[model samples]
Target: MCKAVFFKKLKYRRDVLGDVIVNKHKCLYCGTCVAVCPMDAIELIDKWVEINEDCNDCSVCAKICPVGALGGVK
Candidate 1:
């Protein structure tokens, strides 16, 4: 699906780490975050990514996102 359609279906959420956030519009749904999360906190479900409470805010996924989709609230 296109980015616009993906954005419409997905919504942001508050996480354990107030810092880490994902811009679904920029996300490619490539599972890069899911693979790099050391705590296994990131998941790619269908078209959206979910960061669970297991996340430690290591920023590993944000650093690895090819599209620069993962980031912080700031």
Candidate 2:
């Protein structure tokens, strides 16, 4: 018997940015975070906003969140 290990391929490289989080309880359902991303990495999905891998860790979204819903560790 032979054992093989394989790694999945990624289409895009992920940045080593601090964990970006959206505080759902504090979120206002506003589109401010989506509009502030220079990389076009944020989107308002129905009710909540989602951040995609396109994010460059620029912290723009975090800074723009009026309620401080979005943030990065560093």
Best of the candidates, TM-score: 1
User: What lDDT tens digits, residue by residue, belong to model 2 across residues 1-74?
Assistant: 22332211222122223646778899998898787788898888988877776777788888878999887546
TM-score per candidate, chains pooled: 0.73, 0.71
Weakest 10 consecutive residues, lDDT, candidate 2? 6-15
lDDT of each: 0.81, 0.72
lDDT of 1 by residue, 1-74 (tens): 99987754453334422657889999999998899889998888889988876877889999999999998833
After superposition, the stretches of candidate 2 with alpha carbons farther than 4 Å from their true spots are: 1-17
Supply every candidate's count of residue pairs whose N, Cα or C atoms clash at under 3 angstroms. Answer: 0, 0
| Residue 40 C-alpha lDDT in model 1 | 95
lDDT of 1: 0.81
